[model samples]
Target: MLFLKLLGAALTLAGTARLGRLLGGRYASRTREIGRWRTALSILATELGFGALVLTQALERMALAVGGHPGGVARRAVALLHEGESSAAAAWRQAVTEASPRCSLTPEDEATLLDLGVYLGATDQEDQLRHLKLAEERMVGSERVARGEQAQRERLLGTLGWITGVLIVLMLL
Candidate 1:
């Protein structure tokens, strides 16, 4: 019976630890993704400053960062953008909205991204840069909040795991 109690405690602690790590990993991944998007937007804006490309082409290239690859939803949005101006905007908004739930971003981040889609290629080089900057700022804020929450959650889970384990073992006794 003592052995069984010990085993149960250990398993409980292990599971909590695993869950905490998973949560932390998720936050880290989100930060990386958001950072990547910011970098890509900065790059695009810089390119635009030198010489403007077609809006569709700019979006397609930006998709590489947003989608994480050529086959990403953002890239597909770029294809839709090529069809018509309104369709392209709708596609961008849809992509952002759909993607929000899949990651650790706030609704504000999604809204900022959607707004960015409205101005990405529709504006002049300076305005595009401004919009991209706004988006980057929003992403940075979101990443900070996410990282803080992740750290707190990890700590809480870790503490809870040990506490639960101890309680379980005591109860078994």
Candidate 2:
């Protein structure tokens, strides 16, 4: 499912870029008046950027699903929770890193981690709270970046459509 979503995002990016280029060219030729090249370049850049963001997020999500705290760390955390060996936070951190050191957890993951940590008595509750806050900030940043890219792509496509329509109307007249 993650792979499919990533693939679809990639295809969307490519299609948007191609459509932008086609429309940009037509607009440039018709207007013969202003910054056609700049507009085209901007459209291309925005499309690529959006595609990269989607790909990166999708890849991260896939990695987390494959090797998150639940897979290994969660088990240890649960064990610690039951055995009273350590706290939930500590067990989660240890298990997650053990399973996959490369994991970049999201805000939701951090909340789960903190809850596990407290449940297991792994570390200070404050520390878990801090981690959760940081995760929230990161998630917000990622969301904003993604939204910006999406908006740019839509704007370019809309402009292209408008230009095409105008051209057709002119021809009909």
On the 0 to 100 scale, the lDDT of residue 77 in model 1 is 72
Q: How does model 1 fare in lDDT?
A: 0.68
> By lDDT, who's the top model here?
1
TM-score of each: 0.78, 0.27
How high a TM-score does candidate 2 get? 0.27
- Tens-place lDDT digits, model 1, residues 1-173: 87886787788777766765675577667667667666766766766666576666666666654556212546667756666665656887766766666665556766777888887566667787888788878878877876786677767766776676567666766
After superposing candidate 2, which stretches have Cα over 4 Å from the reference?
1-122, 157-173
Q: What is residue 158's positional error in candidate 2, in angstroms?
A: 6.0
Tell me how far the alpha carbon of residue 78 in candidate 2 is from the true structure, in angstroms, after superposition.
9.3
State the displacement of the C-alpha of residue 109, model 2, in Å, after optimal TM-score superposition.
Answer: 11
Ten-residue region with minimum lDDT total, candidate 1: 64-73
Error of 1 at 93 (Å): 0.5
Q: Where does candidate 1 clash, by residue pair? A: none
